[model samples]
Structure formats: structure tokens, C-alpha cells
Target chain A: MNKGGAFFGVGYLLGLFVALVAFWLAMSGLMKPLLLSLGAVSVAITLFLAMRLDVVDKESAPYLRWPVFIGYWFWLMGEIIKANWRVIRACLRADLDINPALVKVKTRCKSDLAKTTFANSITLTPGTVTLSVEGDKLLVHALYEQDAEPGAFDDMDRRTAAAAEGAPA
Target chain B: MEIWEAFLANFHAWRPWAGALLCVLGAVLVVIGTVGVVRFPDFYTRMHAASVTDTSGATSLLLGMGLMSPDLVTVFKLAAIWVFLFLTGPTATHAIANAAHVAGMQPVTGARARGDVGEREGD
Candidate 1:
């Protein structure tokens, strides 16, 4: 995880605070004054600890680009549905016609967050699994060889880089 | 106008049936995934089969539960479960695959992965 540096601005802290508070409220669903005070205290303690730990950075709180992330998530979900259909068919086919292969895919993501987002998205899609990530190279196992062809992940990689690292789309 | 009015009036009545249908669909997907796991040739391929259950199957079930939920709190909880599952499922799968790779396990690939190879040598 990227720690505090030039990206560790007050905005990130505020964003984290807001997210934590919203999460707490939604999980608890309690508006009582006593419960509210306890929640506030916990949230304050967490924020203080985060500041002391020097982890309040853009990577930690990247909500500024939530719109892009949300859009990418919808696209990813569609990809997942499509991939699921393919895998489901492979699962049901009596012939076992799958041609599984291990392929190394190169990604253009610079930051750890972007790389991780790309890798996780690949793994989340049913047909492909990322075994390991070495620098810009990811060792991917595919249920079907075609799924892991050289340019297969290009679209997802570009979207991930753009969404998580603010790279040019 | 009448059709829209009927749909609006019966929206609540349809919720349970829709929720049940989604749940059944999810169960079927999970069962098919289980079948895939048993039939797939290699560890890597089995993981793919398992993921179908983890992703779409679980998603369908969770969406159904959310729709059937009596209160917003329950829906929120289900959403939280979904977010956490989405985050963790793939990570866990990757970890297992990485471990297998590190242990010198070779996945069957290419033409060899076709139906003839019944048992993996040193599983």
C-alpha cells in the first residue's frame, strides 16, 4: 500500500472520515444519542490512528474519482456476466472441450492500485485467474486460451489504469 | 395506462415471487458450478468453475435476498456482504493458485487438456 507522501493531503483524510462515518451509520442504523456518541468516538479514534500511521493518501482514499470507478464497475459487471456464461457452458459441456493455458499478460498500469485493480478484475472475471504479478507482467491462467491472448486484456487494463490511476482513457 | 396502473398496484405482490425465482436460479448456478468442479480436469480449471459459484451465483442470491428483505437495514447488510465478498473472493482464489504454482504444480494445457487425461499424475 502507498503511504503518506505528496498525495497525503487533508482532502484524503476528510474523504476517509466521511466514508468511515457513512459505513458506521449504515451498518449500525442507530440514531440514538448514546450510540451516536460512541460511533463518533470510534470514528475519531480510527482517523487519529490513521493519521499517526501516515497512511492517509490518495491510494487509501480515492473517492475523488468515484464516478469513473462506478462506470468501470458497471462495465466490469457486464464482463463478469459474459465470462460467467462462457464458463457455465464449459462446465456443462460433456466433451470437456476446454483448452486451458497459462499466459503472461503485460499491463500498462503504473501505480500499485492500478495494477491491483487490473489483476483483481481479471481474476474476478470467471474464465481468467491471475496467479502472480511480477512488475508489469501478470501470470494468468485461463480456462480458454483465447481469453488470455496478447490483446485480450487490453480493454480491461486500459479501463483499470484510467479509473484507478487517472491515466488517459 | 391500465397496464402501468396494474403493475404499480401489484408491485409489492410480485416481489416475493421474483425473489424466489432469482434464488432458485442462483441455486441452479451453484449446482452447475459444483458439477463443473467435479468434472474439470485440472486444479486451475476447477478454480474457474468454483468462481462461477462465487461470482454470479452468490450475486444472484444476494440480490434476491436484498429484494426480499423487510427493511433497509437488511438490504444494507446484504450490500456490505456483497462488497466484502467481491473484494475477498478473487484474492483468496489467487492466493490458492499462487500457492499451487509455487509448489511446482503444472496445469494441463493446450491439446493435452482435452478429455483423454482422466487423472492428474501427482495431484
Candidate 2:
């Protein structure tokens, strides 16, 4: 069981390395000489730190399917942008119908990483905030009463859990 | 009436002064937020102060600078900073609040919680 965690961490590490390399290369091309040097140095330092640090013990990390997780994030970003627009519009209305309340919900994920990701995602979306996480449950506060509908919260858990199904934690 | 109109026109014409005023407004908000953080009784309240300062200060200063300078890069940087703060501010506050709650620090309430959100009596 623990071996699975390490496998996932290694996978995540590789993904991070690739992204950083691409970012560094892009910066070198677009930026001035001094800026490019600084960026290169920063990237080098970051890679050094990441590689040297024993942060990912692997025994307790969560696994995620990279492609699926990327897709999940893209979808979530769209939702967040749309939600923020709605919140802004609602806030500017003459009579604000804000009904701020915190409610508890269950996380379908078995891993700590998935639970934390779910909680953070809830807070990232506009008008919905994660107030607390106790065990596998989350206490979330929504701007409107309707925003707290159980189905909406449950949907996030299901989607995130599905994304992490094959990934090792 | 004509004299008043001239005075208003003069005020508007002093663009730099207006920009300075906006900058001052932003600074004042940040100071007030810092004071609130120091004086507030709890972590949650402190976070509220931080968020208010983060938005008000950054927005005000950036607006002031952008208004003063017509340079494209400077304006872009200011806008970028504002956008970054908007994305991170509330998220940081939420993270702190969640951590404190999980650690079992109940939010201060009633007479102690100053500016506390009122709770219903029945619930």
C-alpha cells in the first residue's frame, strides 16, 4: 500500500520537472539578457531544492492520473471564472440576496491529498469558501443559500475523486 | 456660482494631486488594516483585516500609479499585481481560517468578537 504512494510522488516529480524546463525555456526566449539569466538561476535553484529535499517520502503521497488531473483543472478553472462573474453581478444588485451559511459534506476520496484538494477547490470557486476540514468531511460556506446545495458540493468530490482514481497517493 | 465652477475645474486639472490622493487613500487603508490585525482578538478577525488591507491597499496604490503614469508596461504590471492579489487574498484568508478552525480555535463571539456577525438565538 505504501509503495503506491512513492510511485505517485515520483510521477508528480517528473511532471513538475518537465513544466519547469518548458517555463525556463520560454522565459529565456522572451526576456532580456539580464532577465533571462535571473530566470535561469531561479529555475536552477528551484530544481536543486526540489531534487535535494526529501519532502516526498512517497509512503503517504496521493497518486493522480496526470492527463485526467490536467483536464479536471481546466474544467474547474472555467467553472471558477464563470462563478466569479456571477458573484460580481449578484453583489452589484440593489438588493443583495446573500445567504452566507456553512454546511458539512463528505469526501469520497480515501487519500488525504484528494480531500485537501477538494477542500481547496471549493474555496477557489467564487462565493463558496471552505471553512474547515475535519477528518474526511468539509465545512463550506456559500454566498447564497442555493450555492450550498448538496449536489453541487458532491459533484466536486466525485469529479476530483475520479481524476485521482488511478493515480497513486 | 461661476467662481465655484472655476475652483472645481482647477481641482480637476491638478491630475498629479488627484493621483497622490489616490495613493494616500491606499496607504491609509493598509495602515488601518495593520492596526486592525494588531488590535483584533483572534486569528479569524486578523485575517479579515489582512484581506481588507490587501484589496484596498493594492487596488488604491495601483490605481494611483496607473493614473499618474501612462506607460504601458507600468500599467500592465499594476494590473497584473491587482489580478494576482485578487486571486490569492481570499484564498489565503480561507486557508488560515480553516487551519485555525481545525486546530480548535473557536471564533471569538459576542461582546468580545467586536464587529461580530450576529448568530441566531434559536440555532
Candidate 3:
């Protein structure tokens, strides 16, 4: 097959795989017939465009270390569940008792990606929001003023830095 | 098939009210999350708003829908959506935060500043 056709063939199969997965899940079976038919033409065009696009640097890809990312994600989930429970309890009580404020935390992680991941993880958890991120410093807004304590945010920062360190980069 | 029919046939007796209540609660949570997103001062805080909506609001909606439908397929779809949200939501937020950090956004400080070890460490 010609090089053009070769790339298109790969893209076509990818789209087909996506369509089948969606169908088996029963979420979008209705689109299967249409997708399967148009998949070839669309995939060809997509591949053509993809071959020409060169926006992001390859080095940035190293930050996406799946194993470490998975561990961090699971840890984040546990924190979210815990925070949700706390929020539910607080919401139920007669006293809202929220001392909302923003606090700053710093990290040793040299990579910007690591610091960002940390800030985002904090945002994912309940009762805490990331207000800003400048360099290695992160400003976190917590539902309870006490939660914004330096110790708390710093602990989170350290965990994120560890996850980043464990990443491929 | 008859058992399945029986289940579906009887769904109307309880499903509607359950679905309505769950949906309302989900809507409320999602609204609150959106409010937080708009009210929060920065991107990091905004992530909190998005996460609450995904976990609390979206979870409530999915659970409510699953309860309304006892079918295996519907339940599976609901579970899948929950799982997908659980997996990707944080990752996306992390990506955004990383972008912000690289762009030079700084974090806010609180009254208990001395406790921050980074400051003492000369970071």
C-alpha cells in the first residue's frame, strides 16, 4: 500500500476499535453503523492532518509515566472520598462552620508538570481548591481555614513531588 | 426473558420517584459546584469546583439512574461512567495545573505561614 494509504489504514482501524468498544458498552450503538462506514474517510483525513502537525515537543511526553500516574490517581481518589465524607457531615450539621481561606504551599519538584499535578490533585479532593500556581509555589483555598494550614498543604505538595519523581521524567 | 420483563414491568411503581429525587439532588450538587467554579479566585480553586461536580454531582446522578434501572446493561453503563470520571477527572485537572505552574502562577498563603517548611527551607 502507498504511504498515504498505510497511515490511513491505521487510523481507520483505530476508529473502528473505538466504535466497537462504545457499542459493546451500550452507550452509543446507534452511532455504530454510521461510524463504521464513515470511519475510513474520516480516519484518512485525520491521518493526513496528523502527519503535518508538530506542535508539542516530544520531551513533554516523558511526564506521562503511567505507573506513577495511576498510583497518584488512586491516592487522589481516596483523598476525594474522605473529603466528600467530611463535606457531607459538615453540610448536615446546623453550623456550616467553614473558615474559607487561601493558603500557599511550596514544592521542591523541579519540573513544572509535577507542581501542576500536585495543585490539580489538591483541587480534585474535596474541601480544597487550588487558587493559583506560580513557579514552585501553589495557593490552595480550603473549605475549612484549618485545612489550609501550611503543614496540610505542604504534605500534599510533597506527595505530588514524589509522584512526579516516580514519573518517567 | 420473562423475569426481565417482570422487572421492567414493575419498574414504574418505584423508578420514577427514585429517579426524580436522585436527579434533583444531583442537579443541586452540580449547581453548587458550578457556583464554586465561578466564585473561586483562580484555576486551582476552579479545579475544586470541577472535581466536586464530577464526584458529588455526577456520582449522585449516576447512582440515582442505576437505582432506577435494575437491568444489567444500564447498571454497567452507569458504573462505567463513574469509573471513567474517577480515572480521567484528576488527570485532566493535573494537566491544567501543570500548565498553570509552567506559566508562572503562584499559590496563596494563609495566616499560619510559619508552618510552611518551604519558606524556611528558602524555596
Candidate 4:
């Protein structure tokens, strides 16, 4: 569990700082020096609190493979679009043809971060929401029975597992 | 710089149309989802309808407004709002569903249309 700390000294803090700066800039969109320095103070205070809480670790911010995750995000966006189309059509139909069902799925993701990512991805897509997580099993509710089949989430499960297979740092 | 200026002018002309289209799409989605919530038979089922409003409806509406935004700050704020909703909405939904389940509210499945089989089992 403690495998990634050796590589986590400056690189980890630098990454967090950069993400904070980007978020600050995106939020403010102001180029003035006074406001910029104030934002810097806010980021610094946040980082200090996070450090004090011992949350500057891989478990809390396992985005070391963020590049891969971004690619996965684009693919997930396509999935969301497709799912939205299906849900939208169902919503518009006079006779709602949805066959809602709850199905339990088994996952290979071992750590908390991977499990959460998988669950959030499922919920983010339309037509499916993870109701609960129990060990390796996830209780998912689906709008369509066909989508609840065991094979339906194979691609998603595979990709999620791959994305979460990052080094333990 | 002349081509760039021309491109900006064209974009300005088209932005309103695009924004209107997105807002219309969002409104339709929200109305449909509300109808579904009213029409659905059971608690778990209604949640599915609510999620439709939560995800696509909210996203499109925000994107529409972001398009009409006067500055980058507004766009970023809109994005931040969407992100906040996206992160918290499902968790809230899950929490509610979990609470209902704990309170012994069962989902309406096909076989148990008369609602007899599940009541005894969940306890």
C-alpha cells in the first residue's frame, strides 16, 4: 500500500500546485497582479491544509496517469452521448418502454480509488447508476434490461481496470 | 488579422443561434424527465428520471449559457457549477436510494407486480 511514496517528494507537490494554479486562473480569469497573488495565497493555504491532513498521497490524488485518464474521458463522453440519445428517446415515447432492473456486477479493481472511478464513470453515463458497492461487487440499476446483461459492461470494466492500473504512487 | 476578424464576426453571428438550440434541447430534456418522474410507477424507477434531468439537462443548459457568456470568467464559473453538480448529484441520489432501502422501500420488479414477494424478503 505504501509503494509509491518514494517517488512522491517534489513531483507530487508540484503537480498539485500546477493543478491549483490552473483552477485558480480558470475561476478568476483576471490578469491583475493583486488578485493573482491573492489566488496564490488561497492555493497555498489549501495546500497547507491538505498537507496537514496527510492527504497529499497517491490514494487521495491518484492522477499520476492523468494523460491516460483524459483519453478515457473522451471515450466516456462518446458513451454518454450515445446513452443520452437512448434515454432521451425513451423519455419522449408515449408508452415508456424502459425495463428497469438491478444487477450485481463483479469487478477486478482492488483499491478504493479504482473502485470509485469505476463507479463514478458508471453513474456519469446515462441509463445506469451504481446503487451500492460491496467488496468487488457493485449493485447497478439500469433503465434497459438489455444493458444490464453481464456482457454489457465488459468494455467499460476493462477500460476502467486498465486506467486504474497505475503505479501505486 | 483580417481573416481572423472576419472569423470572429461570423462566430458572433452564429453564437446566439447555437446557444438557443442548446437551451431548447436542455428544456426539452428537463420537461421530459419531469414527466417521467410523474409517470413512473415506483421510487427506484423515478430516480432514473431524476438522473436524466441531473446529467444531460443540466449540462446542456450550462453549456448554452456558457456560450452566451460575455467573458471567460462566466464560462469558467458555469463549468465549475456543472462539475459541482455532476460530482454531487449522483452521490445525493445514491444516498436517498440507500436511505429508502434502509427504510424498507422495495423496487417494483416485474414478477412482483402485486408487491407481495419483496416485503417479507427485505426484512
How much lDDT does candidate 4 score? 0.79
Which candidate comes out best when scored by lDDT?
A: 1
Docking class of predicted structure 3: incorrect
Residue-level lDDT tens digits of model 2 in B7-52 = 7788646656788899998887677657655655455434544544
How far residue B61's Cα lies from its native spot in candidate 2, in Å, is: 18
Q: Model 4, B52-93: lDDT tens per residue?
A: 888889989999998888887888889899979977987788
TM-score of the A chain in model 1: 0.87
Ranking by DockQ: 1, 4, 3, 2
Interface RMSD of each: 0.8, 7.3, 5.6, 2.7
Top-DockQ structure, candidate number: 1
Off by over 4 Å in 2: A1-17, A30-44, A56-64, A167-169, B1-91, B99-123
State the number of backbone clashes in model 3.
14
Instruction: Please give, for residues B1-123, the per-residue lDDT of candidate 1 as tens digits.
Output: 999999989988988788889999999999999999998887889999999999999999999887788899999999999999999999999999999999989898987887666458774
User: A110 in model 4: Cα distance from truth in Å?
Assistant: 2.2
State how far residue B104 of model 2 sits from its true place (Å).
7.3
Q: Give the per-residue lDDT of model 4 (tens digit) for A98-165.
A: 77788999988888877888888887777787888899999888878787798888788888878877
- Residue B3 of model 2, lDDT score: 93
Model 3 Cα lDDT, one tens digit per residue, B73-117: 788788888878865876776667666766766543343321332
Model 1 error, position A90 (Å):
1.0
| Model 1 C-alpha RMSD to native | 2.4
Predictions in order: lDDT: 0.91, 0.64, 0.64, 0.79
